[model samples]
Target chain A: MHGMINKSIEDLVTIQFGADKWEAVKKKAGVTETAFVSNQSYPDAMTYGLVGAATEVLGLTADQVLYAFGEFWVTHTAFKGYGDMLMSAGRTIGEFLDYLPLFHTRVALIFPNLKPPRFECSDRHENGITLHYFSDRPGLSMVVVGMLNGISKLYKTPAVVTHTKFKDKGADHDEFLVNWGAADQK
Target chain B: MTDSAPMLDHGQFSKLFPFHFIVDADMRVIDTGSVLARVCPKIVPGALINDHFLLFRLASEPIKAFNRDFIARQENTLFVFKSTSTDLMLRCQVLILRDPERYLFLGSPWVRNPTELKALHLVLQDFALHDSTVDLLQLVQATSTSLHDAKQLSEKLEQRVADRTAELSMANAELSRVMRSKDDFLSAMSHELRTPLNAILGLSESLAEGVYGDMNTKQVKSINTIAESGHHLLALINDLLDIAKIGAGKMELELTKANVEDLCQASLRFVMEQAQKQKINLKLVMDNQSVMLTADERRLKQILVNLLSNAVKFTPNGGSVTLETKCDLESESLMFSVRDTGIGIATEDLKRLFSPFTQLDSKLSRQYAGTGLGLTLVMKLVELHGGSVAVESEIGKGSCFTVRIPCKGLDTLNQHNPSGTISLTEITPAETLPSNTPLILVADDNEINLMTVTDYLRANKLRVIQARDGLEAVKMVREHIPSLVLMDIQMPLMDGLDAIAHLRADDKHTDMPIIALTSRAMVGDRERCIAVGANDYLSKPVNMKQLVKTIRAHLPNDETL
Candidate 1:
């Protein structure tokens, strides 16, 4: 994996908690990298370990940490060029959900080694839809729901996102039910 | 085909070269893409290329005309263009074709963001969805993220370093606290252990001396054994503490000029009574008529005592123990050696002779009763004075322990003293005991030390008064104004130091002799005692005989009294 993923994890944890808490997480993870280059390649296990260790250090469950990281990833780090690209994908939360597959395909072309999860938006409507997510990696299904929530908030159309199915539960892949619009408004 | 028609493959061109335009040698656009004409409004079939756009790199180079050579050289450099109408940046690959003498501009919009495409009125569908634009945009984003991460990591690392530094300082403070507590424990332990031993030996000696009334031979023998064993235990404790202080480099050697002849006779006379009781002969040999060395008199006497006692103990009833002294002007040192003819030590046992807490044949057998510290203490004392001690022994022949005192590098000098030299073959006190009875003050908090000291003074025919603590001692001194004071240190209410301070403060008693009796044989105990106005220092289990001698030496010789 590129260092961008690992660096994203660090940025998210530090912003949410504090520098001390992030240090505790890194220590728990047994990570030795004092500095990380954004474009340098790193082992995938480092990022995974950071997420797992952050769960323990921050007194949060594994899924909760991943979800929080998912929300933080968009607001804190994915700005400037990537931010504009995401904004241009769709004008509304429903449109963005419909366009998630094409956006990720474009991203995979830029990052050749990236194993982006394949997204499928089915039963799409103005108010609600089921977002199908298939990935070679396990876990992080809750992260997809969190990312959707963040995107909905970015578009100012708050959505209630819940994991409808999981690969760990013997389903073929993970799925999330995302509902938004005036009826789903908080 | 028409002359102004685009001369490129029609089928493959639309998909791959959808953004290209053909220009002739005159720099006029001969033909342009259908998509380009919509996206870029200035592009027409006959419009001049430079009139609508500016090339970023070639504008600064020395070139009047652009050609295939220029295009080939500029291939590594991305040829970026700014549109005059739309303000959009363009990057193109220039291909010079020979068939129609035209430059094929195969390029795409170079915007890193999608919203910028909106400014040009173009959508994702307009560019055939090529992956190049996507890769470029992602590359720009990654660079920005890397810089942000570096800054964040720097700040966090600084915070972590600060936390660690604070922890280290706390640990250092804790270590200092522990060391201070350990020193206090040693001081307290010194008094706690030796006080009881003082009582055991003092009472037993009093019993054996008939002060408490004597008994038959069996009872006398039992009392003697207790006193002897108690003294032995006291010696071991003193040696162990002295060794610890010397190892720590805390022992103060009070350097003074000592006469060679005096030191030799003192060594011989130290063991005179024991040698005589065993019917062993003692002799002294001197290489110089008179010599003086800068040394600690008290510590030098201690080394001599260990040597003389060991010699007397090893020499048989019919044998002799000889002490030899020499002043080596070449080496600038004074030498003292003790030779004894009795049961000589074996070669293997001699190797470990100076190691403390070790006994060879004496360990299992009861023939010899000793703490095995005498020689060890002697070696350490000599080394503290920057000297060396060695031994030579032959089984069945005898053993000889020789110590050389080096005179160097300290506040010490070797000199030849003619007046102080008086070689006496006999072991006797040069000055007779005080002829008249003198009033002496015995001050100590421990009852045993008080009784023992007063008894010794009384037995010497000197009138004695007792003060159990420093306060009473000072009060008695002011009232009766005794001729001399024997002060025991480490007392309750007021220590010997504070009491001496009080007594010395008075003008009339300024010259009065005060001797400090301390059981804490730590390195600086004597120096502390003397600094407070003590005339001399004594250590416990108090030596009654030495106590009497010290009193006589301090009191006026009837002329002043």
Candidate 2:
């Protein structure tokens, strides 16, 4: 995993909770690294260890932690570094989803060792699409759900998202059904 | 063209070079790419290209002319242009196309920073995926974050240091306050203890001198024992007070001219009786008998006496103790050594010899009956005179303690005494008095002190008058015109210094001799008494013989009862 992912998680925990809580989480996880470099690569076990520690320390389910982390990644981490790029990705939410498949391909040029997850959109329409997430790692379907909510918030269109399929339940990959328009403004 | 190859169409070409523009031979805009049209709206298909963009350089140098032929001549050269409409720049390579003679300006937007990218309303996606511009911008941002982290850590460490320094400063101030409090308590205790001791010594002396009545042999021996014990207690109290004063930096020297031979003889005589009691041979050897030193006379004598007493105390029966003095004229210094042949000190025990109240062996303390303060006092007093004391010894041989006092900066050659104190010889009433008795006035708040002094005065056949306080003493002096007055400094109504000042203010009693008496034998007490117009100062408990001599020395020649 890239350090950007762990950095985002650190910023999410530290900003929402306190720095001391992040320290407690790190202690529980037995993580000794104090600061993370953005483009550096870390072992996959570190990220998994952090999620497990956050679950015990913050008294939250792993799914809830991943969901919050995903939302934070879109709302804060990505926007802070690449706000203009985010805005230029699409003029509308459907176009942004259409660009998501090629988003990691463009970013991977800058981060040479990036092992990016794949995103695809099918059954696309004016207000919704079926967002398919494919990755070698398991148990991250909730993060995609949270990222859809973050995108909807960025476009100022309230959204309703449902996990349509899960790889844990013997599906091919994870799938989400997302809908957003003036009809779902609340 | 290859037979099996596919060619790039106009739409494919526009997508490939989205910021490219084509110009005619007349430098007019014939066509513009999609991104160039969107960024600079002024460039149209029919407008003049020179009106929308200015050629900054051709072939990496300043452009000579604004014609298409000049641009075509600069082959394999990079052209730089700044947009007049949006202030965006372009680094381009010109290609000559020969369908109707056109020049294609094929380039992307030239962005060096993130701010420039935003100013041009460009995003990372606007550049082709293979461009390295976005990577450079992200690297810059990461370095800035690292700098920010370092700055924050430095600020936190500085704040921690300031907090720790403040804590240490507060602790140091509290320690100073505690030390001052302890010194004040010791000073107060010294005065309180001496006041009672004064009465005890004064009344006992009067009894021993037969002032009350004649006594039997048994009663006389008991009185002598009580006097001896009282004197011993007085010496211990004085030593304790001296140690406290020196520790507090309140001990001041009263420098005067003193003869070296006289000082040595007095010290040797002081411990002569103890030496005889232990059957030890005491001797004095002086190299220069007439050498004089300008120093604090009392403290110098005390230093010598303390060393001589220690030498005598440590020597066994039938052992020898010697006091040897030498005056080194060239060095302008004096050296005094006290050597003893007894159970000599061990090499390691010599280091602890000058530490206060520490005997080398506890058993030696019991057998020798010593307070163990003699060498400590000797060292301190010698140091007060800017001198050093050294000792050399072996376990079976003798110990020699030598003290070196530097007299280089002192006024040793001038042999005159400048002290204004009256030298009171031991005088009886029959020798000093005339036909009429002298009138003496005694003022004291303590009844025991006043009674003891008055009895001694009357026993000497002097007419005595008593006042309870300084206020009454002042009134008594104005009324009775006594020959001399003895004023106790601490009194109920008024203190002796104030009474003396009040008398000195009056023209009639300006010459009245008022001696200040106090239990506070501290550094500034005598100076304070003299500064307030006291003729002389005496510390209690006063020796009766000495008191009578001081009174006789202060008595007016013609004044009588």
Candidate 3:
């Protein structure tokens, strides 16, 4: 996993919970890192440990923690450099989802060690789309749902997302069905 | 290659280079890319390119011409031009197309700062994906963000440290204020208590001496008890004050060369009566009887006396108490141990023995009445001399308390004297008086004090005069030309300190001895009295014998009676 992802989770915990709680979470996770540099890679197990500790320390489920982190990623100013990158994805949520793979490829150029997950658009409709999320890391379907909602908020389209398939329950990969109001209504 | 081999159409070219423009040999714009046309509306078909734009740089230098020869010479190198209307610098790669012999300028606007991108009405998307300019913009923004965050964090940390320092400073100031108030209270309390006490003890001493008249045996015994109890109370108050002074860091040592044997004899004499009353045997053990020590004479005597007194008090009748002294020349330290073969102290009681007001057993404290401050004072006085005290005791055998004092500097000449005992020198009073009475002036504000002191002096065959205040005292000195003046401090209408200063200013009275007497026994009282020209200082509840002795010591032989 990239440190940018871990840094985003740290920001989420510190901003919402408080810096002391973030320290406890770090200690509970047995992670000695004081500061995480963006565009750097970290052990995937370290990141998973943080999430696991966050669940026990924050008194929240893993899905809830990841969902909050995903929502915070798009809205946080700590990653303002990625604002232009997100803006260059597309004008609306549907266009953005269609261009997600190419966007990740460009992001991989910026973070040379990034192992970006594959995003595919399938079963498209006028007001919705079936999003295929493929990654070696599991148990992050809720993050995708949160990100879709966050994108709808960005585009002012008012979205609702449901996890249609699961990888943790022995499916080949995860999937989310994203639906939104007409763009003109906003 | 054929010109028609699936070449990019106008739309494709416009999308590829949105800021592109083409100019014919006549220097008129033939066509402009759609985006460039919107930015510079005058650069359209058949418009003059030179009128709308300036050739700002050629080979990194300013070029004023956009003619054919100027364009032909700059072929492969980069060129920079600016739109006159927008003041935007455009980096261009020029291509010469043969079909129409036109020069096509293909480029985008150049920007250095991220803020410039916004001011130029450009976004990151305007630059082609292959260009590194957009990445440069991102890096600049990231650097700015990191610097801003670092500055904020530094400021926050500095603020926290400043706050903590301020809190600590406030606490320290408050503690100092409390300590000052406590010292003032102690000084005032001591002064107030001693004023009446001086009269009590002085009159009792006079009564016991039969100054009034001869008394019966019963009266003599009762008077002795009164004197004894008064002395005991004075001791308790002095001990309390000493403890307070030590705790306040105001106690100081007056170091002097003192004969160890003399010191031991003086200390033993203090507790000899008590040991005799209990029938406890007293013994002295030392390697050499003439060994001398460099120490504060008074305080060393006080330390040894306290240990011996405690030893005598705790030991049963017929038990032996011993004073042992050893000098270690190698370590330059002197050790004195007081061991008692009495009912021994329990092991558990030894730890709390030196804590003030702590008695091992309430029953024992009642049985053995004491202030319970002796050991504590001993420990503090020893520490002031850069020394330590240790004790060894058993449940049924006895207890031994040893004090070790380090003395790095001592005069070898005084270290040993062949004489077995050194006699203390004292001032001898005049055996005969002059025909005229010698006048002594006593100044005090309190009536009892004035009467008691004058009565005591008169009984010693001296003519006494009285002054109620410093003003009257000074007047009496000039009027009577008294041989000696006893000045009381803290009087109304000019204090003793001022009175002494006033009298010393006169050449006629400069030779007259003035003794400053005060009820306050504070740390700097004596020094302050002497600083203002007082010949001597005495703390009250004055001992009449010491007072007369001090007067005799300071009086001239011609005047003393």
The best candidate by TM-score is 3
lDDT tens digits, residue span B63-177, model 1: 3345455665765566766777776777787777777788878888878656576576654545656637755665666666667767767876997788888888888788768
- Give the Å shift of residue B37 in candidate 2: 4.3
**Candidates in order, interface RMSD in Å:** 4.0, 4.0, 4.3
Tell me candidate 3's TM-score on chain B: 0.63
In the range B508-557, model 2's lDDT, one tens digit per residue, is 98888888887765579889998988888888767788998888888876
DockQ sort, best first: 1, 2, 3
The collision pairs in model 1 are: none
Q: Residue B283, candidate 2: how far off, in angstroms?
A: 4.9
Off by over 4 Å in 3: A1-151, A157-163, A166-186, B1-81, B87-109, B112-115, B162-245, B248-265, B276-300, B311-374, B390-408, B411-561
C-alpha lDDT of residue B379 in model 2: 85
Residues A138-177, candidate 3: write the lDDT tens digits: 7877777777777777777888898988899998999898
Evaluation by lDDT, superior candidate among 1 and 2: 2
Q: What interface Cα RMSD is found for model 1?
A: 4.0
- Per-model DockQ: 0.24, 0.15, 0.15
